[model samples]
Target: MTLASLDRISPRKGRLSHTTVFWMVFAVIMALLVIAPFVLPVFWLKFLTEILIWGLLAMSSDLLLGYTGLISFGHSVFFGLGMYGAAGALLHSHPANLWLAILCGLAGAGGAALFVAYFSTRLRDVYFAITTLIFAQIFYVIIFTWTSVTGGENGLIFSRPHFAIPFLVDFKFDRYTMHWFVLALVAGSYVLLRRITRSPFGMVLQSIRENEARTRAIGYPVDRYKIVAVMLSGLFAGLAGVLYAVQNEFAAPDFVFFITSGDTIIFNVMGGIGTLVGPIVGAGFFQLLRELLSRLFGDQFPYLIPVGMVFIVMIIFLPQGLMGWARRWLNQ
Candidate 1:
């Protein structure tokens, strides 16, 4: 589709604004989150936290690809950098707040993005993906090579964000608390991103995605816009990375692995890339399938379940993701 056509494609095409139904669904989600800790098993909460983190990562990818028409194959760099930065901050800092660790992770990822953007913006289409993949490999090498600093192959293990207070110097983070805190953060991010994608900038990227040449010819600084989009995506991917590290209490070179980027792409498509709520639903569904398959077949069933599920989803639905179905149902 053309940029103009996409822009004029009714941004509100699927926005159903019946206040009661909207509030009811939201209330139900919040209610589940609230009573979930008491009602469900402990480890389930941890799983949900993972869903949120990956959901954020998927959303970041959607911004680059679904909106800006830039398909990246190295998003793992942002995610891994965030994980390393957060872990490193907690381990090295004298005073650590979860908030500060998150900020540091974001800053670290942003800095890396700045460097990557210098060369990446020079490429377009598949070349962009190739360059991004190279960047991801560079980061993987950095973590693996700088064993002394990033703990090399072992990575870093810590209890929580490091904070040595004057009086209470020995506080620890409860798993459940961290889970809920990250959930709140994820929910907040979801709302913020929703608003962002509805704004003028979002439209610009959507425009660019549909037709970059036309957008550039119309006098927009296409490269500059793409760089900004990449930066924003990296920032959120960093946040997701920190959450992943803290929730697992582990950070490793695996965080930047190529598969991590591939998995994020899977979630983006599985959840419906352009749809706002798709990532969360997609992450939740995939995680559930993973747990179920692992329990049934040990480790062998692994990717089969997700890939098989994807096959089914694609065969029947074609262009639509899970959220797309929901939107169609709601609109009906």
Candidate 2:
């Protein structure tokens, strides 16, 4: 069915449709995160941090692909750019400054997103995807070649900086502190994105996504709306990148590579596109599967096989994704 038809089908209205259940689930997750540091092994906690970062990336992409209905193949450009931007700040600064690095990265990625969206949003569907992909590849090449700034193919490595707030909190970038930081950041991001998606402006973006022609006919400046949506997505993706760099203590050209974009797409599709939380769930599942399979099968058996199998099973059994299926079941 066309997106237009899909847009026309409304769920049966009822009090059960309220967001109370959603909040309850969110609260439970938060509580678990609060306890995770105590319960989970340090190594595993680090893995979980990676999951949160990737989940954020997946969620950011969902803003464009899931909500705005714009599938950007080059979404990782912002992610990689943010990593390099933040890494650069941290490396060059005398006194390690976390906030400054994050802000620099965010600004760099946001600016790049606006510039790319200005041109790319004019295209639609496959054309738009290709344009974004090309841009991303170009960025990857630039990062690869720029040894002075990006550390070339070797990438840039730096110790995670201390939070510069001397007066109130002395936050260190150790594994334990970072894991909690990631959890808090992910929670905050989810709440912010949820609010954005529920806003009137977000509704307009969905309308555009469902049928750009119809939305434009009704008086919305379709291109501008799309640009803004992409920018917002870029901002979040950038934030995810900064977190990734801090957690890994490195930034590489691979961060901006096409594969990164592809992986995020898989995360969104597997998790259930259009469901904001689904992407995070999907990221966690995917990462856990990879980690487990790698250990179980060893180097002889490629973990990708099991990973692929799980995604296939998910597609065949829960095509709408775990969260999507859950929502349907609950609403029913």
Candidate 3:
């Protein structure tokens, strides 16, 4: 618009753009990840694994909430489906291993999403959320009531992590190796989500989120995209559930419970929803805080008080969350 502003923005012919700096920062983060396993404690490492799992779940929710403008409270149903699917697979006539059971769980979540999204996608906002919530509770009740199959309240605790192969004790109870496994999955999910966010599909979802009517008028099949996104989200959430079941070698009826889903939503909001990376940060923050509080305060009255204060402070001061604050700080 003006000569002074133009001169400020224009490159002096050879400098790297701001995009280059962003990558540089990301590269440094990757380097830190490479060294994390050896540095982190065993307890914290396991906690991080749970955080990564839920972080991915929250990321999937953000895909619907942030990118597609579809907020369905029933995501917990898909999450539960995956959990039970994995557990049930192990109980089948021909029992499945952890990996196969995980796959089965993801399939179960995806299948449920397919069945629900078919009808729910036609609605919007509260209607869609309510439909999902009802279906999720239905699934929860089914899991709760189906005691013989689900092992009832006692739960099913299978033997230790037995590899299909003969003698690989390294991956069994060695916290170090187990942590590496989790780290690899977490890193892989992060890369996949980044690509999803940058892909054409991601852009289309964002467009739909911004204005579905205009996107549909411009010839995009908006409802179909939403359905696909929901299924995909379930796939990831189920994968997370499989990891949860395997890591614990136990499956509770509560896997598909509404409270479990609510926890994820809280984590998503706490971490800065829609940013993709925010959920991981938020999950880690909360888990770490919870652990520390349990140790320091011992589940007393003021236990939640500190955690609540932290969230309140974040909401008021850093509404966008840690990633937002970091971006601003780095830019400045």
Q: What digit string (tens of lDDT, one per residue) describes model 1 on residues 73-95?
A: 76899999999889888887666
lDDT, candidate 2, equals 0.86
Cα lDDT computed for each candidate against the true fold: 0.79, 0.86, 0.74
Worst 10 residues of 2 by lDDT: 1-10
lDDT of 2 by residue, 133-228 (tens): 998999899999989878899999999898668688876767778888888888899999988987889889889888999999999999999899
- Residue lDDT tens for model 3, 1-332: 23422332355642355547657877887677656677888776777667777787777787787668887676788777777788777666243465668678888989999988998999988898888888888887877777778776666666435435436532454565555566677677767876786688987888887888999999999999989988877777777777777677777877677777776766777776667777778788887887898898676646677888888888899876776676556556
Cα-based TM-score, every candidate: 0.88, 0.93, 0.86
Tell me which residue pairs clash in candidate 3. Answer: none
* TM-score, cand. 1 vs. native: 0.88
Better of 1 and 3 by lDDT: 1
Per lDDT, what order, best first?
Answer: 2, 1, 3
**Clash counts for all predictions:** 3, 0, 0
